[model samples]
Target: MQIGIIGAGGMAAYHAKGFTLAGAEVVGIADPNKPRSEAFAATHAIPATYRTLKEMKTQHPNLDAVSIVTPNKFHASLTIEALQMGLHVYCEKPPARNASEMQAMYDESKRAGKLLMFGFNNRMRPESRAIATYIEQGEVGRINSAQATWIRRAGIPGFGGWFTDKELAGGGPVIDLLHMIDLALYFMGYPEPNCVLASTFHDFMGNASFKGPWGIADGTGKMDVETACHAMVTFKSGQCLTIRNSWAEMNEREVVSTTFQGTKAGGKVERLFGIDGVDETSVDSAVLYTEEYGRQVNRTIITEKDETMGRIANAMNFVKCLMEGEKPANTPEEALILMRITDAIYKSSETGTCVML
Candidate 1:
């Protein structure tokens, strides 16, 4: 399969690598910055570069698919355009800046009859896959309550760049942390979210000690987004999930973990990797707690680093779906639901009241 990347940043490079790893051709790269695009093409050995998707389409008309790794603001427009061009899209998380745009992308994908998948790479992690399989196998029956978090001690990305710009990034860790929330909801079978109550904090925006590793220094750029967020999501099935995400905080350990409580058994998936690599580097693991012979038993499932490359798996799945007519792992419809919940969470935080979905 021949593929192209829509951005020249770190994520776009990552997707290019994944496609190469899957033995697919990365024909072109599209970025507004010519130097960045040229450098990426040189590094990735891609033969073509374009200033925009339109240029890429004109030059590489045989492209089979493209990865949309641009910022939140461009997600909807770029994704819809790619779909309309009859190209399958693998968009980054959050789907779009808002739910309305996400709906348009979804509608366009259906109209174009192409596969649209989100970069829910966390779900493809070996630990996450194991937990999902466990839940599907009824090992953890009917999850009722869950808490998912991705916390960083000082791990903001691009302090004053698009990552911290509300207009470009949409929001802070809440928007960026959609992967963790999506993982929780995915394992919970995607119950309908009834409402959301959320709060955002920007306490560390201008703090020198909290500046993260992704942006420029000197601190002269605008930082209008939150550094931390907390949310409570209620589902129609009477199940609830609490999300806690932060780009900066006063903590020693950093973690991306989720704990699920089910009627039959309880399980936890934990990864010590932080946003800025503060936490210990170890294998991601999932633990199951169950009563065996009237005694509590814990089973640990450890996933090695080589076990799964979620980004690669996602890319391969897209290729396979096109070639074999297989079903997608993450659908645009599911992504739309996630965007609605995310919009509600942000609105609730802004209005200081619960927002109904």
Candidate 2:
């Protein structure tokens, strides 16, 4: 497979590496920043670089697919364009800025008969996949509710950049942490959200002391997005999902946890990442609790140590799907649902009322 990358940021580099590891030739890299594109191309040994997707398509006509690793606001337009140009797309998560854009992208993919997979690489984790399979096999029975959280003590990413800008990034942790949110929903079988009640806060907008693992803060740019968001989404299946995410918080440590309650058994997956960030194999575990043979049993499963490996697996799966005429596990339809829920979260937070899906 000949693949092209649509952005020259950290994620684009990571995806290019993954595609290369998956036996795909990264033919070109395109970014608005010419220097960044050139640097990424040089580092990856890609033969082509472009200042825009148009140039990339014009230059690399043989490219089989392209990964949209750009900002949230650009996802829809780029994805639609790629699909229209007869190219498959592996879009970065959060789908788009809102549901409407996501739907359009999805519709384009359907019309084009091309693959459109979201970059929810966490779901490709061994532990997460194991849990999902276990639940699907009826081990956990019918799920009732779930709590999904990814909170940090002081981890505002790329402060004053597009990450903190509402126009570019969409929202705060609500958009930023969509991977974890999608994981929770995936475990719940991608239930249709009936309504959402949410609250958002911007307590640490311009705080110079808090910085995450990416981007440099310039101190003069505005942080016009939320830093924290809490939302309760009720699904049509009567399953409730509670999501809590914050880039900056008054806490001791960063935590990633997802707990699910089901009719037959209950399970939880937890990971702790300190000041830097989480590693692939760092402090991750999944445990299930249930009664068997008149005895309580707790089964613990160890997740893969490195997230990068899972990303490689996901990239491989996407390439395999393209080669074998198989559909990807993370389809744009489910991504559309996720985006709808995300959009409702923002609306509900703004109105202080439940937003019906």
Give me the candidate number with maximum lDDT. 2
Superposed on all Cα atoms, model 2 deviates from the true structure by an RMSD in Å of: 1.7
Q: Each model's TM-score, in the order given?
A: 0.94, 0.95
Q: Write the per-residue lDDT of candidate 2 for residues 18-135, one digit (tens) a residue.
A: 7887678988888988898888889889998888888888887887899988878899999999999999999887789888998899889999999998788888877787788789
Q: What's every prediction's RMSD, in angstroms?
A: 2.0, 1.7
Clashing pairs in 1: none
Residues 1-357 of candidate 1: C-alpha lDDT, one tens digit per residue = 889899987667667777777667889999999998999999989998999998998888898899998889999999989998989898887789888999999899889988898888888777888888889899899999999898888877766677878898788888887788888888888889998999988887867777766554343456898888899999999999999999897776678888999999989887776446642344477899898998999988876663333766776667777776766778877888888988888889889999988
Ten residues in a row with the worst lDDT in model 1? Answer: 274-283
Model 1 ranges off by over 4 Å:
214-221, 274-280, 306-309
Alpha-carbon RMSD, candidate 1? 2.0
